[model samples]
Target: MTDTSDQLPVPQRIPSGIAGLDRILHGGFLKGGSYLIMGPPGAGKTILGNQLCFNNVAAGGRAIYLTLLAETNSRMLANIQNFSYFTLTPIADTLSYLSGYSVLEQEGLEGLTALLRSEVRSHRATLLVIDGIVTAEQAAPTVQEWKKFLYDLNVAAEILGCATFLLMQFEEGPASQPEQTMADGLIELKVRSVNMRSIRELQVRKFRGSAFLEGGHNFAITQEGIVVHPRAEAVLAVSPAELPKPLATTEQPMRMGVGITHLDEMLRGGLPSSSTTLLLGASGTGKTLLGCHFLTQGIMQGQKALYFGFNETPAQLMRKMTRFNLDASRFVAAGQLELLWQPPVQDLLDVLAERLLNAIQRLRVKCLFIDGIGGFQRTMASTERLDLFLTALFTALRTLDITTVCSVELPDLFSPTVTLPQTISGTTAMVENILLLRYVELHSQLYRLISIMKMRESGYDPAIREFRITDHGIEVASTFASAEAILTGIARFSTVTPGVPPAFETSARPLQEQQS
Candidate 1:
């Protein structure tokens, strides 16, 4: 039989040399296709185009960078000199930089197309970058002439087996542009001002034959070039079945102790490895202390841990933990723990997620603690993305088999509601366990109460227990036998019939007996 597979030619792709951008493109740009890069004057379109050219030439492909703007070649080269990727010698030999301004002025669109064709063929270039299409549009007296020029340019590129990038100053949206219709792909870069701060974003408006991540991803202009950070919500790769096997012994299912004896008894032993728990409470309700206990437990067990303190500085966290007799400094000094403290305001969610994932992989961390999840919501531009972002993050941690504890603060300190705050609603569905800490007022005295609200695939104590932060550490009492409505912030005893036992009698036992 004839081999029909040989009749189909292999598809070709060109790497943009930007890791995140390539990922957003679902691989890379299709080879031998024309793409349009549009943005405002200072949106880094020219820089992106040039960076692609340099990266392609470095990969054994010749490229031409032709500019039709008033900016001179020397000025452009000098501007790019500071970038790490801008190499002088290789750019001089392999890549060609030519000015199309004079040609467009002398012979109009026809001469510009002819010049592009001549240079692409003479240099045997596989990539061509036209850096000033807006100027070319100004030169075209009629719309038909502009369309003809674009058609000619595309035909020339296809015939010569060259991939073309047309960079233009797009002041407005490109929804109605005829040039957009002709190009095989369109990439848009934008700089938006929010509360007096600039945020750079990139979007793939069109990729004719390929599926790309369809969203505005955050990007930044660094010393190297434009680096894109894809939104975590758009990319969900984590799942329990895909989790890496535990690095330690595989003889039994791994579990991490919660560090509190009574809490462990309530949890039936401890949290399962790779599970995520959310500690929901109000301010000054021992959430941070609980997270410290979890991390300290992991460190004591010889497992690496990471702590992302969203609101507290490292020193502040150390001082606070010291009050509870937990010394995080020693573990940090020994490199068994990583403590990162970034102010939540003006922060990008994707950037934080990236840093967290990188730390988990680099440290091979098995335990993670995020203090101030309520403050984490302040970092996002919109509250709607918080759920998706947290879901993706927890999934990624689960895939790495990292047990995590995140603390979220409620709005009303005295309210008895157990739901998440408005800013971070719907995140409870992603959590494998939920612990609620609340303030209780009994007999004109303020006390702390703890409850295991929910536990997936496991049984937990259903009674509300009173806890105290002593000089040594947190001490958990058995269920509050003296109160009936302790969780409502107002505690009182329930009346009972003379012949029957009180309701609190069976609901709680002594701490010593419960632990045993």
Candidate 2:
């Protein structure tokens, strides 16, 4: 008797049966509550609602999908048959698809509410989806009548403990309609033009009684229905305090070779394991070859590896690697290596990040080579979120203990000194190491030169060394100590001793010859 009647009921969550969607909702929608889904035509409102209904019904709860459009039931079935979720048993038995258009036109809003109440009771349905709520709004004589009808429907749904969905046709931004006020949650779908391509996004405008993921999450309508790709920054944001404590500083960090002895020596042993490295180079400067060497070295060390190629297909990359005598197909067949080829064709950055992370986790990838960061950037519509995206991505990699090397093509090869492009989203600071590969003209010959520009963890050799790609692998030649302008894309003898030939020219001989 202690004010029990005034107690608020516990909110129950109903899973949408969609992985990312449930996470966005912080679980799922509140059960026994009416929600509104607003979107423009062809914005996937109907598909989303239908997916939820079918998923609920499949989980042993009955559902009623009432469409206010005048389309025939057979046509609706045919239209939905293409989706992978559509099944004959659920459609014929567990779920009921009814038309509310005739009821609204003939009997008006009150009749529509009565029909919903009767159907909910008869079917013993826990889920109710009213598609094309715009028709009922139009059929009502006044705004007050529509509000009354919405209130009555909500009451009826609440009485039956049925989670309800009202799909409304919205062309633009959020509207201040009475139905929205009456609903417990509001979901909006949008289609926007990005770089001449349309991208579908979903947002939760309001969700009562629960904390939800805000902002827009990209989605797509595939044969499996709606799949949401939550932005990594929003989904995986973690505070530094949340990260696990590191080991004692006295314990030396592990390192891995880059498949070249001299390069490893310059790196003070080798690259620090689990560190992120940026390979800044121009085209034809052996960036891809360097990445191949990294992956092959990992494979040789019995570590799993992943090569995410943006500009080349798996077959193409493997064929290219054959020239270096690195046969990746064996490791690929052994399940120790994964070659993922994704071209920059209307790809979403969030989707790419999710896919890469998933692969890394599933494959237990210890070494990762992302060939062509520039190609990945081409897929993004805006660079504004790139910094946050990179932060989240690198944090995840470090947490997973994956050593990553991403190759970014320099815009101009003829520049005197290398500079991180202003267009790059401040990702340089996040990288633990920076290796600059450039084309330099020395003695009327274009040669590849590499220099360790920065190493965060420890000191590294700052010498500009000549490198050559051979049939076996990449080999580092003698340092360009005689060439003062090595990094200026133009080179000349720094100090000449008349009797001594150029050090690089003499040292550019075969490895065996130099050894001899």
lDDT of 1 by residue, 1-516 (tens): 889887767558888889889999988887789999999979999889999999889889999999998899999999988988899877777899999999999999999998999999999998999998889999999999999999999898988889999998776664868789999999999999866778899999999878889989999899989889988877665655676664555444467987887788888888888889999888888898888889999998889998987778889888877777888788888998888897756778788888887888899999999987866677666678887788888888787778999999887677656656876678788788999998765455565678898887577788777765655566565445533445443444333344332234323222222211
Candidate 2's error at 6, in angstroms?
12
lDDT of each: 0.82, 0.81
Alpha-carbon shift of residue 176 in model 2 (angstroms): 2.8
Residue 211 alpha-carbon offset, candidate 1, angstroms:
2.4
Give the per-residue lDDT digits (tens) of candidate 2, residues 192-260: 898788889999998888988899899988889999988778887767875536657776678877887
- TM-score, each model? 0.87, 0.89
Best by TM-score: 2
Cα shift from native, residue 5, model 2 (Å): 15
Give me the displacement of residue 437 in model 2, in angstroms. Answer: 0.4
Clashes of 2: 0
